[model samples]
Target: AQSVTQPDIHITVSEGASLELRCNYSYGATPYLFWYVQSPGQGLQLLLKYFSGDTLVQGIKGFEAEFKRSQSSFNLRKPSVHWSDAAEYFCAVGRLGGYNKLIFGAGTRLAVHP
Candidate 1:
């Protein structure tokens, strides 16, 4: 079975500081990797995704991720984080055969200190 792991359960950073959230997956083949952000009391929103093509994929809200096949990782990064960026980050892995099923890691709660 495929699985995802977010090493950091919680991260605190000053506003405007660079941020990187680690995500590693275990899969037989290259799988679809995604980063989703959930604001307080809100549903998850897709931040970025890596399915194929370019290894460095850009997503909404100044966020990006690099798919490193060798590392089995698709880590999310932001050059500069805003106070509004404080939220829960979730890394998910979806099999190539289906999109409906996604195995999510234990979310990383991000706290932006102003």
Candidate 2:
């Protein structure tokens, strides 16, 4: 079984400030990790994904995440955040092959202050 945990329920950051979102997962094998963001009343969009190779994966909207196998963590980071970056971010873990169900965390809502 695979599961994800996002400890922070909400985070507020000033505009242009750096931000980091934590995510932890439990899985039997090497898991496929993903980060998705959803704006208010909008569908979720894929931010980034890590299947293999590079530990640090770059994502859209100036987002990046590093996979730490030892810690069982994949944390997302942004050097500088803008007001538009405010959204609900979800961390998910899934299997590699075909159609496997993705287990997602509750989600971390980011609030940007001007």
Backbone clashes, each candidate: 0, 0
Give lDDT tens digits, candidate 1, residues 1-114: 678999999999999999999999997666889999999999999998888899999999999999999999999999999999999999998866645588999999999999
Model 1, residue pairs in steric clash: none
lDDT of 2 by residue, 22-66 (tens): 999999877999999999999989999999999999999999999
Q: Which regions of candidate 1 fall more than 4 Å away from where they truly are?
A: 96-99
Instruction: Looking at model 2, report the run of 10 residues with the lowest lDDT sum.
Output: 94-103
Candidate 2: stretches off by over 4 Å: none
CA lDDT for candidate 2: 0.96
Candidate 2 global TM-score? 0.96
